[model samples]
Target: MTRTTLALALAAALALAACDRGPANGAPAAAPTAGAPQAQAGQDAAAELDALYAEFWEESLRLNPLSATYIGDSRYNDQLPDTFSAEFRQRQLDFAQRWLERVRGYDVEQLEGQARLSYEIFVSSLEEQIEGERFPGWQQPLNQFYSFPSSFAMLGSGTGAQPFRTVADYDNWLARASNIPTLFDSAMANMREGMANGVVQPRVLVEKTLPQLDGLIKDDPEQTLFWRPIAEMPEDFPEAERDRLTEAYRSLIADTLMPAYRALRRFTAEEYLPAARDSHGLDALPDGEAWYAFNVRRITTTDLTPAQIHDIGLAEVERIHGEMRQVMQEVGFEGDLQAFFEYMTTDPAFTYESEEALLADYRAFEATVDARVGELFSLTPKAAFEIRPVEAFRAQSAAGGSYMRPSEDGSRPGIFYVNTYDLPTRKTWDRDALYLHEAIPGHHFQIALQQELEGIPTFRRFGGQTAYIEGWGLYAESLGRELGVYADPYTYFGRLQAELWRAIRLVVDTGLHSKGWIREQVIQYMKDNSATSDTEAVSETERYMAIPGQALAYKVGELKIKELRARAEAALGEAFDPRAFHAEVLGDGSLPLDVLEAKIDRWIAAQS
Candidate 1:
């Protein structure tokens, strides 16, 4: 799941949530699994693969410092890669090419079970990275859903990954912060290139970014989020040093960061916004169809065509609507499904009394779900998690709830950020399903476990495939009933509504990108089929517009996991265990849907 989502949708609706277990899959409870023979030659091959992975990780960290900071690796805290630069893009291309060749030198067939799996995944990822170079992702760098400026504010706010524990940490951020001007310039240049190539973002999406930039650029440095570190500076620091740092930060914010933000804000408002495409679909641009197709392939990790996915979405929407009808009957609502949807969306009882009540309710879910988590999950992460609100600055566009993967060192607990901005709109009915999807036994459970894995390579541990990750979150939501949730009919309806939203995304995302659907069409689709508020519909549609083929992951991944579970239950009969099946699906970390399917098949065969 990414850091953001539509407020109507669960946060981290598209992120890393895995359910791994078994010694073969790096679970502590399982014995050492060696599917390869004890032949010396085979052992050497496996050892070599491990060595390659280690070296690759080391080099990768050096190249991508932001990734290092993200995982709580402070070694590169001072660095910020110029991610939008042509040089950086070329470097990425070169790294993939070199690694692809280096990895191919080893024979995957000669490797044992886990080693073979790692080798295969690494090879496939590198190949995809190489293949992906054809698409001009660098041209379309900024989206309200995912942008550098907002992320920069989070990093420098002293609350995100940039540790503010020591004096060195302060200095490290200063070094990192100094690069903002360069990054913004790079972005401006890239957007210009995008305009030239007819690859510019839709005008509506560009408009959403203006308010985000406005929030970042404040008149007084002390009033800015960048000043937060100084405000919360460690008391233990020598007064003289603290004083010196405070003055330095004041200058940095006013002189450097402000100008950078203003320059970008001005460019965006004056030039880029006007140049942005009026058309909504990716099909409007040159090679837009192919670009979207590549994205669909990367996102779903499947070769299913757009038409196939669109058809799948339509079927799923119909099915979920039928389930919603069941909920309507259970709730004894006098109206039709649409009327009930309108009632649920508009009802005052469904909303929290205040933001405090909203956050408190979300926090309370931890203990509630904790009591039942063990019934379905045999293993849980050692790294704990906490519930927090989405920062006010971005909350307008933020998802209902999102999960941040824990730091590898366990110092940074996974954060489940619930949006408390639009308090009245943040429905109580959504709380349970949102929690299950983004918190315990969902994003938090799957993503943290994947990071904490011992034997898996860093790529599989830290990197993720969207479909499997999001699918697991969606699948985890289905467990609410068995986990003692969805007990109330309205609550159960919320779960179905959540599922329906995802299915709708499958339709709308494909519709917007490939099937000639406009923004209004997508919004109307949500209003008709689900309990999505107008604000949620608009933002959610914009989110799909911003990132094509991404929203499809939730339903596609969930469907696959559910399909696997059903297959296991039917095949093994009395031998079927939900917990074990979950562990198997998540055990290998995130995989391409086909690879995940193959792995699940292997587990099913073993069970048989």
Candidate 2:
């Protein structure tokens, strides 16, 4: 599963600048003598830059309150922005331009080490934020995978990043959620504009969204997920406080939220669905080819075109198939790759009997991983994680497993949400690899550790590059054997199948967006190639359709990471330490692929 957050959709568009001077590891450089004017000047410049970074993070939090809430900042919990509005879009553009000019004023040549690195990254982030404005993503904001409506439900439902413990927390949500009607109005207006300009979502995605909104919209306010907090209200509160808060919540749902939801559902069904395009690819829209090209560059953090990525995917599919054949031979299977895939996918022995059993197996596997995770890497995050089943409302569209990072203050544990929606499709062979990817040593370790990093600017701490983040998760799956899991041939095949799936994403995602492959064609390609179930194929296919160029990040990132590992191993010979290499790769937060490569090269040089 990809990283999902309630933060602004454009949050990833902003670049991540570094904070602490020194290196990516936050290690300080030698201090210069006090009498030296150049040293004093450099220190002064670095100080000024740090101040700018702090100010930027604070301003950004106010602009995107949900971002602050996710990161454990409660300063703006009662605030909500109508991010889909034209005025808000212009404000973001203006903010990016202003920061770009401000950061660029610093003489990057005068900056040293990580200070220089931060300057470059900050500038790139601002430029990307500016460049991305050309695409008009706000025009097509609502999709099955993610949208403000869906995200708001998650926040108000009381089980997500938004806290519901304190009375203030309850009040904060009531205040924040009261803006739903306005947000929905703004979204509909933007989508209507999109409908006029041939920029609407695919019909199938919109169709899927209708059911989701239906599930959340109820006539009785008490029945909705929004009432979860009220139902589970603290007993310690005074009787009058509880009674008042309860009534307020009921009114909030009935008077504010339900009407907004109904209107959104009505607009989506009656008007938008009719105008929704039949075509699946982003390239089908106006200026779509260039838009998709930009998405490819930003999502993968590379200049590789769609064609190149498609070809790379083809080669990877072939390579991983060869490995799967080896697994088949080990198991003494007497069938071709397709038959093996069928056996792996359909055989009842691999299916979980119940959601309870599925979750139990994952919990047990977490312990299994913790037993020997020490051998692979010494560096680890302080934040702990829990394996929970995905919430029912959005499970149909959710991935098999996804990770949510821990809060900044360490109050909340990192969540690895496993989808137990279709219990039959939750295969036994798939669990280990999924756990490895989404929980231990995958997203949980990388993201939570990044959040725990000290001295980095908040942007670097919370900022994401999809290729770096998802790539590391995919790369983590490859370490199953080394981490003491993937013991059986079947489990090992699960690892190969997981990797093969990512490889297939590169092909199918690029195929749909750039190469004119339709939704059915992509789904067929997945079934033809790997051990994926029908539920998974359909869900994943629509996911790519909903969010173009995102699927490419997993394999592209994993390949880059693997390439670097190989390079480090070869250059260092026996002197290489996997733990140290892992540390160097993750010491800093998310980076653009090229920036990551350059940093790794420096590490290799240092080792030599």
Candidate 3:
């Protein structure tokens, strides 16, 4: 995914609202001399600091209005500013620069605890944004992984970010939805620029976009997902206003939205596809190496090179495969690993009878796991969650399971979308581990609790690091045995399979983007090692292709958390409390892996 895609999604979830400081470019300035004016000012700066941060936050909310909307702040909802325009982008750049200067001038040493973290976060965020200006991300906005079209669909689907309860809610959406045409046009214009600049999406991804767009274009507006608000218009709405709005929506859907979607689809298929690159790597485009490097840093939150990540992936994949072989032996599969994988895939018992059965199975896993979470975790989220199948239009390409964080207002519960597009491929073996990772105490607990935090700055509560968030999710899967669900050998093997897939991602994501491995090679590698079906393997490989470096986060993060847990267990001896240890790791929301490690080390030392 592009930075904007991830940023927009993160913004929508209200996950990362804090400012982030960039790494210092040179030596730190010497500390203010004791009793100097700077030191004296620092001692009395808390009240001023609070005021500065509040101003910083209010300004930030205005700049990224979608973020304001997601947090239940309606002040900027009707203002669909042209974020894609050059003027707006420059304005954002200026905003970051100005804020960095404003915050950096403060006497950080005078600030205490949370205030210090707030200052660090804000400065880092500003620097990261300014540094990112070197990249031409706007030129390549439309990818199959996430684009304005897909994001708009999810919002208008009635079950997503857009609220449909109140008249103002309906109006908010009508205004938001009406801006789709301009965004769509901007996407087309950007893609054209991409074509001219040789920054276009891969041919494979553009082809995927066509079918997705086709799914969104329906003959009857009332039947479409976008038409949801009109159908559910609040009873409190004035009759004249409702009728006018309904007819206006119908005309907009039939005339503007549907045709624009179709036109984009046609343009991509007929015109863009022919010009799209056959090569899967972003490195094929201009400054592609720098671009991919930037993505690696953004997603992994580390300076590790692609080659380094590729090597780490290879090592983990081999290590996980050794464990899988033990599973093969336990099952008495008298064959090679490939044969065992095939057996696992084709076995009738591993298949769900239908999508409902699949969702039911996941829900049942949720209940089973929840009953035992007390054994492993002390902290839990107040927000509840449910299991639902991926919406049909996106199911074919969606992951096995993905979690959408709950709205800050708590009007919408967290949702874990399980892809049931191909039932058989949605194997029974995958259910237990997937549930532990996506629902209940995994993403739901960590993310929801973070949002509900009362004292932290808004940014830290909402902002996240991939290594911490995804790493926590992957680590949650490892809790299956302790939480009482990995009793069956098959289920235990599924847990291993989940880890193995993340490990393989570390390898394949790096290989495809950095090592120049072809798509088929990655698919064949997955098929040889794991029980995933060919169809599932292909879709996953393509997903990694579309969003380079993202897959690395899971394995990289899980390994660090696992490593830390092992250390805590070894050092604390009888004092190690899995519940407390889990709370410490999760209570701070998501942090850089190094920061998490440092905090845990402090905990361990304190206990000692």
Using lDDT as the measure, the top candidate is 2
lDDT of 3 by residue, 1-608 (tens): 11211236321222234663222332232355676785455545555556666666777778776777665566776656666666767777776776676566566777765666667656766677678787676766766665567667777767666677766776777777677677667767877887898888788888887888888889988877788778777788889888887887888789878888888888888878998998988677788788788878877777789989888988888888888889888888898887878887899988999988887878777778878889888888888777778888877777888888777777778888888897888888898888888886678888888888777767777777777788888998898888888888888888999998998888888788877888889898888777888778988988887767788888788889999999999999998999999988987777777778888998899999
Every candidate's CA RMSD: 5.4, 3.7, 3.6
Q: Write the per-residue lDDT of candidate 1 for residues 325-444, one digit (tens) a residue.
A: 887887778988889988998889898888888888877778899998899889788889898888988888877778887778878788998888767778989988999999888988
Candidate 2 residues 1-608, lDDT tens each? 65535564323322222221222122233344567677576776677777678878887777767778888898888988776677777777777776766565556666777667677777777777778878877788889987567778888988888899889999999999988798789889988999999999999999999989999999999899999998998889889889989999999999999999999999999999999999999999999999999999989999999999999999999999999999999999998999999999889999898999999999998889999988888889999889889889889998999888888888889999999998888899998899989988999989988888887677788877899999999999999989889999999999999999999999999999999999999999999999988999999999999889999999999999999999999999999999999999988888889999999999999999
C-alpha TM-score for every candidate: 0.94, 0.96, 0.93
| Rank ordering of all candidates by TM-score, starting from the highest | 2, 1, 3
- Candidate 2 C-alpha error for residue 245, in Å: 0.5
- Lowest summed lDDT across 10 adjacent residues in model 2 is found at 15-24
Model 2 ranges off by over 4 Å: 8-40
**What is the lDDT of every predicted structure here?**
0.81, 0.85, 0.76
Candidate 3 worst ten-residue window by lDDT? 1-10
